[model samples]
Target: MELIGQGMEGAVYDLGDGRVRKIWFDRRPDDVRPLKAFLDELPPLPFRTPRIHEITADADGQAVSEEDLLTGTALQESGVAEEQALDAFVAVVEALRATVAGPASKALPVLNQPFWREDLSWGEALAALVRRRAAESRHHFRRDVPDFDNLLETLTTRLATIEPDRLSVVHGDICQPNLLMDGPRTAAVLDWGFYSTAGDNTFDAALAAGFFDMYGPDAQRLDNLLLDRFERLGHDRQRMYLYRAAYAITTATIYDADAGDGHYVWCVGNLNRLPR
Candidate 1:
């Protein structure tokens, strides 16, 4: 096997055949079974999603799973025209929005783990998540943000105003790396489960547009382009900004508990730049 991809959660390896093995850093077989079950039952969409062939344990008892390798260059690295990339990105979100999740998917875990409550609306749950994450990690960001509390309060207030949404599969992380492209079309969507949930489809739309470009030198301009595209397509621009801010705050300390990583820095910068 050859190491192909790595991230905060796990490492992925090519299994020599037409499959890959993901060695989870902190998950167990049972931990991901629900995700596998849910993906297995998904109705066909315009693009391919993950398929977990099986989950097992390595010698160290860490979860190891084999899955079909849906091959494509990541969308951002595929050299497709910017317009084409943006179109594919928005198309994927729209596809998920149009397709409804069945009852079996209700068991899929959301962004905040066991803290996720079923009764809360999508926006309400996100607001609660902001509170939970802030309680644990605010100290690391307060000095830099100065008005961290005020910003957080405002974010939660805006979150509370989101209208109730239809239940659809929300792919919480739809950034460049997760989107694979063959030519100008989306070949597959990879790496599910960190924030996969059964919730409002608009949440996916908002986050997908923001995640399109978050760190490049032209990031702000590209972000504006995607936001404009979504707005023209009827997505509320303010709500997209609100969701982006909430995502930054809630995930600032997720990959680095002490806010010491580049992603944390990105989150802090995003907070500082929020609509003032």
Candidate 2:
């Protein structure tokens, strides 16, 4: 097997059997149960999700899975036309929405793990993250306000009051790189490691909006496309936009903490778009 990609939580390997092995980092016995539960519940959802062939738990309780690797190129590397990318993104989102309505969908827990149910609304979740960041910053650097303080405060104030009644199972992380496109449509949604059941569909849309803002020249086009789809689905455009801004900030903060300057650059791009 050859290592193809790696991240904070897991590593992907080209397993030579026309498949990929995604092995999670060493985990405690307690963590295995939820992961196993997630893997077991993945196949029944009604969307373009990867099919897991097998799941194996090592003696030390770490989990690994071999699954059908998406044969098509990732959207980031596809060199697809902007209009086509937008269409594919919309199709995938619709498919995911349908999946959330399926009876088996609720088996998988919300993406943020143990604290999932507590923050059922997107705004609540963002507020919790902002509060956690503030506390962490205070503990690490006393007195003065941190760079993220203002951004977090503004986002929390704006989003905290917005009601999040639109619920769906979201792909938690919906960036371009994780989406695979074949021909002109999304073939499969790879990487279910961050899948969740509690977030609103807007959470996924926000992720898509943030990605287009980061990579595409016609950033507003992607935003419009997503909002149009949400409207067709009967979602409020204003709320979706709010979640998009919040999601962008939340995403950038995670990357900035884990990775470094590259993520900071991404953070600034998203931060600049927050509604003044």
Candidate 3:
């Protein structure tokens, strides 16, 4: 086996066949079963998506799953022109938006627990989730974002205004790493279940726009460009900003619970800079 990728959730290894294995860092076999079932039932789309073949547990009790190998390089590493890549990114998001959320989509658990409630509206669940995350990492935000409380209040207000939405399949993490490209087209989308939910489709649009290049020198400019594109596609700009802020606050400590990574810095910057 050859190591191919790693993230907070797991490490992926090429099995030297037509398959790859993912050794989950923080999940159980049973925990992944619902996600597998959800993916297995998804309607066909323009590009490929993950398909788990088998699941087991490691000696340490981490879940491990084998999946069909997706063929292509990550979009960021594929040398595709920035313009073309952005178009493909938008295309995939649009495809997902076209898929109306269903029972299976809603039944799959989101990344965080306790905050997610089937009876609650998407906006309410999202607000509760942000509150949960903020409570967990308020110390870091208080230091870096002097207006942490105000920002949280602003986000909560914005979320409450969202009301119930027409549910769509929101990929939740449509970043460069998770998107594989064959030339200018998306070959496959990988790594579901981080923040995956069947909530507002604009949430995916907003997050994907910023996630295109979070750490690059041109990150902010590129983010604005993608946001403009999405706005032109009929997504509301304010709603998008609300979703982006929600993502920043909710995921600030996701990878590093103490909020020490560059993602934390980026999230702080967003918290301070985004209009409240």
Using TM-score as the measure, which candidate wins? 3
Give lDDT tens digits, candidate 1, residues 1-276.
Answer: 999999877999999899999999988888878888988978899888889999999888889999988899998799999889889889988888887877556777665364346587667877887888888888886888878889889899878667555778778888888889989989999877777777667677777876888777988787788888878877777777787788788888887787788888877877887886
The candidates, ranked best first by TM-score, are 3, 1, 2
Put down candidate 2 lDDT per residue, 1-276, tens digits, no spaces. 999888877788998888988787964444545544555565454335666676777666687877776677788789898778777776666666654332233444433433344434555655665555445333222222235566566767876676655556577666677777776767667666454544567667656655654645666676667677667777666666666655444444354454345554555555565555
How much does candidate 2 score in TM-score? 0.74
TM-score of each: 0.91, 0.74, 0.93
List clash counts for every candidate, in order: 0, 0, 0
The lDDT leader among the candidates is 3
Model 3 spans with C-alpha error above 4 angstroms:
none
Error of 1 at 88 (Å): 1.4
List lDDT for all candidates, in order. 0.81, 0.61, 0.85
Deviation (Å) of 30 in candidate 1: 0.9
